[model samples]
Target chain A: MPLRLACQAMGTRFELVLAGQSEDQLRAVGELALEEIQIAHGRWNAFANDSVLSHLARCAGGPPVTLDPETFDLLQTCVRVAKQSRGFFNPLLGPLLHKLGLRDETKLDPAEDLGTLLDVRGLVLDPKGHSAQLTRPGMQLDLGAIAKGAALDLAARVLVDEGVTCALLHGGTSTALALDPPPGKDAWQVVIGPEKHAPRAHLAHSALSVSAANSRRGSLPRGDHSHILDPHRSRGTRHLQAAAVVAPSAATADAWSTALVAGCLPSDPPQGLGLLTQTTSDSWLLAPGRPSCFHIEPCTTTTPPLTAAPF
Target chain B: MHDNHSSPDRRTVLMAGAGGAATQILPDFLAARPHLGADLRVGLVGVGRQGRAILAELGKFDEVTLVAYCDTDERRLGSAARRAKGAKGYATQDAMLAAHPNLDALLIATPTHLHRAPCEGGLAAAKHIYCESPLAHSIEDCRAITAAAASAGKVFQTGYQGRANPVYKLARSFVRSGAIRDVLSMSAQSNQKNSWRTPASDPVRDKALNWRLDPEVTLGLAGELGAQQFDVLHWFTSKYPVRVEASGGILAWHDGREVADTVQARLTYKDGSQLSWNATLGNTYNGTQEILMGTMGTVRLAWSHGWLFKESDAPTQGWEVYANRQQFHNDEGITLIADATKLASQGKLKKGVGLPHPGLYYGLETFFQSITQEKDVVCSAEEGLRATAIAIKVQTALTTGQAQDISEADLASK
Candidate 1:
């Protein structure tokens, strides 16, 4: 029997489905996973003054501040992904987002130029010393695109370490991590957008993340102003309708999904990754090795809407 | 000291006494005079599930001694006795009271229907009483127990643990301090997915164990769970509800249970402020929380956590630097209320897997402190009766398909 628990964490709904354990044991493990997610939120949240991200943003261009191992590793991952995407996935765009009134209030240095402040290369990390410094005068870090995914990944690791074999973890219904499949089943069956005519993916030991820019705007006239911004262009991207990525980790899938939809990276994802892109005219799916793993039904007249993201 | 020579039948004497101001002044006057005791001897009735928890909390105080344990279930009585070490076990409250006549206080954790007898008995024995909430199953019983506690001149604490929770206290202070401005309305919810029945080894005990499923014995969701939340509303607004309209049904778990699994109620106060409360056993979406909306801001409170959402034009309280760290629904998280700063300073908060059950622990500590210091209890019998009256009225409104008005005359009626 499978047990499911739902809780609110990281400003979104999180669901944990576990098998091969009693309800009591599953509940205990679920609580542990939620606690871990809260700790991650406390560390990586850009809005909180007590968070390490805020601390780094405030102390930019000053003495280096030593960070905890968890935060240091997260910063390292953010820098690595930003470099991999050619500054398209930069975390130093917090000031720009704040100026646009897209996020909570943030303090930015008044004297520094916007270009220097939004430069991702200005962040200096020393892994050995467990410390980081913002080399520029006005740099700020925002992990809005990747923190939820990272929290989900950490929660999944908690379940696995607790001896849970078949489990599925989701953060806000957009980012999901599937552990080993249920007994006698090939994989965890997940339905992507459009319930009636949508594509269904069989996920086995993988993670899926979806990014939709127009989800929040509904039928408003300002729907064209996308929330997903291209850090390289320093503006919102409105070309793509939706994008989904399947990778070994939720953080990777989250980053790529944002990158693909923002037009920072090409629609054709790198090798060993699955991509699903939806545009105004048509939708496409590209699976490198197992192309037939997903089954998509023909579009019906009343196509169901895609799952909305909380970005 | 209480005048024990007045009458053994305190209920009769109290019913005949003046109803106006004496009843209000007597408890306060008696509470001001110390009982002159260094050690407190306590007796517990109904040492079952919730009883065991109270017993453990009581054991934490060195000045408090568990003198007797009483329960109808022999197995539970024996277990409680073992936990209390030197405490004696009995099969009835009468037996325990007779054996321990000098008990300073009696903590009653019995079921709703069984509360009146032990509470009145403890009062007649000149013992301070601490009774669990939803004071009794009927309005008459609640009136009788409260009247007895009043005339007996003994400390009577009701277990609405929210009154003892620091987070709730802090949130209440924030709302009342004019930080949130004129209160407009409030809403509360408690959602949980559970069977609400404990397993039993015997067939007969199985039905008895799940007494909450019986409509006659239980007050259903409103009485059992909503009592604490209603108390919180009163504490925050300083006003009892004037009228209540409610609706409920057994929406799920159609397993021959008469009580409703889901309930929604709205209460109207004299000041035109309204409060809405809903509870369901079928879903656990947001778990449990209470939200208070005002002219300037809003306060969302849970048992273990709380957050304040201020309006954009409202004046900043200088705590935004701390609150802005966590965000939910565009609201900043207020860390001062929920975090363990006090416990950390006292070296009591631990970095570990489990959190402390602060509500019950602090509630029990308050009960003991009232006994030792001759002070008024945080949740007195008057507070308990008012909240219970509202909850009972809500239940009545649900069943009668009409709104019910709460009156002081009805609360004071025997």
Candidate 2:
């Protein structure tokens, strides 16, 4: 029997399913994985006054703040994704999010000028020193987009390190990672959307992350204002309804998917990642980059999908 | 300590014990003494869960530089080093001390049984030391660490966090100033719902990692969790327990572990006031807190929040009108605001209800203050030993199903 466990962290419920010979051992390792996710949440939750992210925000414009290896890597990944997505996936849009009244329940009018504080370059990261410094104060690094995926990635690593090969971990069902195929199954089938005709992504030792503009909305004047912000325009993105990405790393998939839906990246997806996007008109755009562990299959009675040119 | 039986002026008493003088807009909020002293370089020993938490809090201080971390477990050391930015990794405290002679201080978060080596080594290197609470598992090791710290002529602090917390400090003043009147009894509990087993791929490493479950060296729940809470009562009352009677069993998580998952201990002080403490790993109801029941009222202290309940017949204070009160069944608790006067004046008393940070942050701040400002250590080694001695007695009593006598000799460093 597979052992199932769940924990609430990062403002979402993270669940894990593991298949192993010993139930006791699996539970122990599974609990440890959950602990890792909680640790990640405590370290990076942007709203938490005591989180490392808040500390970094406070220390901005001062000396470079040393970060733990994991956080340092996450920040590096954020910068890389920001550059790859042409600033659509900027992590420094924390203040803008606050202005748009998307950070918490407290509502505030969205700011008109958005580009000044969204510059990813202002985040000076020292690889040799293993430190990061914000050139200006009030510059916040919001990991809302990629933090869940990073936590899932870490949890999956724990499961793998504990020699548990068959495990499925998901953060709020939006970001998921598969350690290995379950017994007698080729891959883990993950439905991308809640629709009856939604496509299924067969994940084998890979990750899947989905981002939708309509998933979360703020109390803005515009009824369709989403939590996903475009750093350049300093407003919510409405270019695409939803976007999903499949990659070897959950954080990578998460970043790329957010970028795709925000309409930040080019029409063609990255080389190693698979992309599925929904247009505002409700049409599906498929960009299966390379033959990898991630494969997509349409649901029964699902219409034909539009395919992008090979990268 | 001031008399506890007298009815002092409410605003005067609250302001005097509110950590600092009320010159700022929000006295309690600004109770955080700014680190105005010179910057200090520090290293951490035992890069485990607690060590990582310390790293996060230490990062908040601008004057402190995390220089290195030492852990026998290379995986934890490497992981912790990455989080600490440029902090070098060492396999041993000696290696870290030798590599960074300029390291001004060392924060020890190792297992209770493994504390002596790091404490002694840091002391030998003439470095300021901050060891996590319940100083050690055994009475002898606690004495040794205390004696070494005394001879080192360096700043030594134990991680009994309550003594340094602003809320606790504020609450302590109220208790000492006779706000609660003569204390009749005290009780504390710490509940966390998880199996106390750490995961490791290797069996040998797993055994080493789960030291809290090791009956020989481990102090079980009473020592590991109860000692910290017990220290709060000791600090508030400025008294010691003369004897302890405890009973516990493996009521939960009987997965081939000898350590009890639930424990109940009653400690009797010289004045015959008893402190009942319960620690459980199987349940997390009500979380963790310490309660002081007095003739006049009761004071409840959670790590982040605190409250004082006044008897209906007790003398009412002028500040009671402005204080925030929370209802608990039939009882009502007046929220113990550290700088109630300053906040009350601004009509922001509600915002100053709880601490901005955890108790650990304040303890680290105090340690840094002691190092740079030449201030007194908040929770010294001797106090840590006394707390540890009480915990040791509790553990012995629970294990043997008998009452254990705690003498002054058990807590004395000499």
Tell me the DockQ of each model, to 2 decimals: 0.02, 0.29
TM-scores of all models? 0.53, 0.85
- Clashing residue pairs in candidate 1 are A48-B325
Candidate with top DockQ is 2
Cα RMSD for candidates in order: 15.6, 5.2
Please give the range of 10 consecutive residues that has the lowest summed lDDT in model 2 chain B: B1-10
True contacts kept of each: 0.00, 0.33
Model 2 TM-score, all chains together: 0.85
Backbone steric clashes in candidate 2, count: 6
On a 0 to 100 scale, what is the lDDT of residue B34 in model 1? 20
lDDT of 1 at A143: 81
Residues A204-300 of candidate 1: C-alpha lDDT, one tens digit per residue? 7888887876665643223345778876666777667777777888888888788777775553455676776666535554533533455655533
Runs in model 1 with CA error above 4 Å?
A1-311, B1-37, B201-204, B322-325, B338-357
> Which stretches of candidate 2 lie above 4 Å from their native place?
A102-115, A193-197, A216-225, A230-237, A263-269, A280-283, A288-311, B1-36, B66-68, B84-88, B95-103, B178-185, B201-203, B269-273, B293-298, B307-357
- Write model 2 residue lDDT over B78-178, tens digit each, in one string: 67755777679999988888889999999999999999999998999999999998799998899899999999999999999988888887888888888
Best by TM-score: 2
